[model samples]
Target: MRQAEKRAIERVASKRRNKNSSSSNDEFEAEHICIRTCGRELKCGKHRCQQMCHRGPCPSCLEAIFEEISCNCGRTVLQPPQPCGTRAPECRFDCTRPRPCGHPQVAHNCHPDDLACPKCPFLVEKGCICGKKTLKNQPCWFEEPRCGLVCGKKLKCGTHSCNKLCHRPGACEDEGISGSHCQQLCGKTRSCGHLDTERCHAPYPCKEDKPCQAKTFVTCECQHRKQEVKCSATKIEPSPQRPLLKCDDECLRLQRNARLASALNIDPQTHTNDHVPYSDTTLKLYRENPQWAHIYEREFRVFAEDRAEKRLRFKPMKAHQRAFIHSLAEDFGLDSESSDPEPHRHVCLFKTPRFVSSPMKTLAQCAKICASQDSSTQQATIANDATAIPYNALLLTNPQFGLTVEELDAALRKEYAAHPTVKFHTSFLPSDEVVLKGSGTWTSQTLEASLTALKSTLQHTVRRLKLAENVFLCSVDDSLNVLRREGGQAQREGGWSAVVGRSTGRIRMPRDR
Candidate 1:
């Protein structure tokens, strides 16, 4: 077939899929009308909900079909909920395609299709390569990476059209990311290697020829009060998910345009294009409009947090236990001379319990180093005189500014293995290094600061959960709280005093008590 003929044939092939072929699908579309005004029809963002017109106004249409359009000028308010089709005075035209105007939105003078503003100079179509109108859906990607062309429907990324994300048209830093170099040609490329591997493993594989032939299979559309983790600060109920309505018609195309319109809220800095700010209200409306399964925005956030943290934790689990010391040292920025984390002698016993002990020598040296270099890191109110080893001492060797259980294990090994004349009994090891030189090592000022840092960290983690203000962090051990919330804060409850013993900056073995 000729190129133009093939294009026509393909476009028709795409359009044919839009028609209502089955009663089940039609019923599904009828029951739930996804508000195009919400990010998009199909690809609703399952994240935080905020300022979308759908969440703000389109509540009625969630379960309702196209009824009427309503309008109200600033001077006169339209009281009654008019039909979805009922047009009014203030707005000149509805989306040319007859999409529901979710609310009395900030009315723009120009037509939805017109990329240009009424008389605004900002609507210069200087980068109109496709020669398409400069409306919202018809975004001028040529103009800038994050364009503001608002559409009345969803926007889709066909393997061909989505040259940027799906198949990255040109070569980036990524190898074999070129169209000619997909899995078939350059399986070594990162995208090809990882994404293709994922695709191959999928029960429904993407054919080598038609990589993007796979349709949108599963989507999470959430509604109801679902809790979510947000910004390491709060547990918020994120917006619901909007499942896409599969179609091949212009309506679907228009919905896709709408999806693109409400779809992205880009952070120019990180180059992360998140779904528009989602909220519980926005999500509920989104789910009602185009109902589908969702991880829910809040749930998605929580899911992501869990995923990231698990990823963070998984590294240590994956590595050899012998490398534990190096991993912790590298993770917490520990070095040999710094804490003399170098080498020491050891006395061992069976099964290093969940909590292990280290000599005061090591702890004292760590305190001195932290005090000398990054004195600001010296937290307040540490129980230096406590019979147990300080928790921060184990953390002094953390690669990532804070300490984790992995680091403790790593540090214990680091101290013991490096000791030239190490003596180990069975599983337990104790170091003989006189880490701190002077009687002045355990100071009121030093201990106080360390304790304060621990308190501060634990408090922060609890606060992020968005519980009551009175809620203070109480954990299996405040140390676990401290360990988990390092660089964060936790809350404490009424009349509940923290044992504040040896978990966080200090370690207490079975014998230490």
Candidate 2:
């Protein structure tokens, strides 16, 4: 009976146990729905889980999972464990709760006591305390206000707004709808029904707001005053009339007169009378007074008489003298050939006064008489001579005044040696004179040429020696016959001086006669 009673109790216990097991199974299945949907391993009651996993784990499961994983700070909260061999496993945990110092919860598994927690403040998820979304992850420990997201909207001035982000929590006094400080200084409605948003310090008045156009007086070019409308106060235009001085009739007349005077002054015709018109004045005088013509005629007759007298006085020997002078002038090429019948009254005037004193021979007479005398003397000398000598002689003045007779002889020898075709003899005469006698088989022309050559050589030698001033060379025959007088006293006289003294009426009377 006791055994039967125990069996009944056991069946009842077994039935109760199955009911509890089925109930627990339904609860476990309901909790595991998250894991099944996420297709992940169960994390519930795991020692590493700190936060409840939204996919699979619950708050209770996270509390139980991290129950034995104590942080170094003695906090029970810990991070979920990673696989053993995974790189950089986050095996540590942190208390993500808010702190009294306005920072995030301290981190676990840190070093020194001071470093037990992350000293920096936490960033608000939405934004910073200033409500700027751009402040995400920024340190909360910054004392000054922080500005982060840029405000890119347009300002009232029609220019771009300040690009600075919103200010920190306590920085701004007024905040706009964009969560930034209000910085708009323009964008106001005007009475003209226009949005005049320009931040202009000095506003311009419209045309309608300007004062009335002013009235002023302007002078015309004729000096007549006229009324003119001026520009508006806000506008600037050229003067209604140019600022010019109007001229009167008298002024214009003066200017015209001045221009006309200038033009007349510049005219060539006006200046044509600058020089004295003597010829024109004389012609006009003669034309005006015909009776005065006799005066000019009488004066011209006196001039002609005077000219004739002067001619006769200057040339006393007209018949033979004039003819002789003309012949000489012709020979010397001093006279021009012309058909004019008038005598050359100016010809044959004695250059020296002494020639006028005696019965002088004109150059033509002297040339003819001397030439005849030369021929006659040459014939007489050749005929009267006993020896049939073919020789010529030249008389020359010594070129070197200071040279000795020996030096002179040596020069003459040198000169003679240059001409091998001739034999020469040199002899000294009275005064500075030398005579050279040459014997050669030569004609008159060849003799002349040799004489010329000898004279030239002597001249050059004298010059090289820097000799005396005068060196005269003449044919011996011509000098003795034509130039010298017959007496021994006359031989001492030079040819030119004797001619001059004898012609000047200095003839000595014959004392015996």
Candidate 3:
């Protein structure tokens, strides 16, 4: 060992001198035979290695003749004699020679083909550690044969009663479904359904390979309940429609007047007021609904200071009272003159325009993810079903895509963000005044200038608005040659030149064919 170390130091010093020496004026030194490459002694002959003959001794090792490693099977391979690692049972390539060392015992018999030694951490009793079942895209964590992280924890099956052992959904905090986690115990092996950390794992794209090693794959975030790329998926343009919202039955019974229900948007058969009408607006709305006429004049019209009396009085809307907010809106409007309205009283933030995405994006989702890449590993499981992250910063925080408070905050921060855009819903209508069309003949430079002017006025009122570009979805009527400001494309000239795109003159008009 001492001699080898000394020789290595001498060789390194010699190489450094040669690299630094570039004296053209000096006489050319004859090539030294001893220093020249001495290649691996394969069966071909005691010849120097092809690589060493061209280059110097490999940087990987100090020896001129390197030992070749291979798997237990017939195939031959090359591996570093010793892996440089601090961890016990460090990973290494398999040494597959029949008779490698000068020892009497053959290498295969001593190490055995079925088991993996500490030098090469990929062995199992029956098959390859890689071939073991594991979660898709997770790292392999096999310690030795079957001894692993899973062995320590006594399994608790969630599905059955605590007395009876069975893995059930929501059975225990760490309990996973048998089918969901590939029926493998935790820590024994990784599970499937999640994305590999090395890949765009939004939509899991791979399956479990029993032959593949555990922990070699990465853990996915969307296991059990698949997670969406919170900021990436953007459907900027689509047809407009409302989802069906349902409410429970009990709340439907107490609040049962159609006129009052119509204003508060509650079913006359349902609804019990949750909050007392502190302001006078509630009092007027309580009477205005024709059905509440007797109650308005007789009971609710008179003011009572007793807090408990007021608390138990009005009706509470159902739990899923999204649609019922109209009754509250009407109530507030009814008493607008009597009391000062809240700042947002008139702004229609909910239920109007059919929101379409902005054609524009603040940043490309892929660009950001790729830019922040630390690992270049290709995660096969998530390679196919990646969700397109629109990559909008604003959209991440704001409720642009019909989001409420709960879903947005919990999403991964670095993975995606919301786009800045003006959303136009179905309730939203474009301006009535149509701009006149201009001449078809225009340069890219001219078109850009015209488009810029149109954009300024069309921008959203709030800079932080999480809406995507709704304008891109705005298409001109067909057969009418609307002036479209599309760059490079010839101003649409065919058909009845009535519809004008922004490039023409920011208006729609007709021109002769």
Badly placed stretches (over 4 Å) of model 3 are: 1-149, 152-436, 439-480, 483-513
Most TM-score-accurate candidate: 2
Q: Give per-residue lDDT, candidate 2, residue 128.
A: 44
lDDT score, candidate 1, position 100: 32
Off by over 4 Å in 1: 1-125, 131-161, 164-329, 332-513
Clashes of each: 90, 2, 77
| Global Cα lDDT for candidate 2 | 0.42
Question: Relative to the unseen true structure, what is the C-alpha lDDT of residue 189 in candidate 2, on a scale of 0 to 100?
Answer: 27
How well does model 3 score by local distance difference test?
A: 0.30
Q: Give the total clashing residue pairs for model 2.
A: 2
Off by over 4 Å in 2: 1-395, 398-402, 467-472, 478-513
- Per-residue CA lDDT of model 3 for 1-513, tens digit only, reads 668856875887788567657656455663543444456653333343544244434333323434444434435355555332211232244444433222232233323345653333232233223233333322223332221222222234332112222222244333554434223222211142122222112134333333222111111221111111211111231222323333334224423332354576643223232223223343334333534333432322232222232111223233223122333333322111111122112211121111111112111222333334423335432432222111111111112434333332333221212211222112211221122122235543453344344443333422324432322211222232223322222233534332223235554233211
Residue 81 shift from truth in candidate 3, angstroms? 36
Tens digits of per-residue lDDT for model 2, 404-448:
656656656787788888876665543334566666787856775
User: All models: lDDT?
Assistant: 0.28, 0.42, 0.30
Order of models, best lDDT first: 2, 3, 1
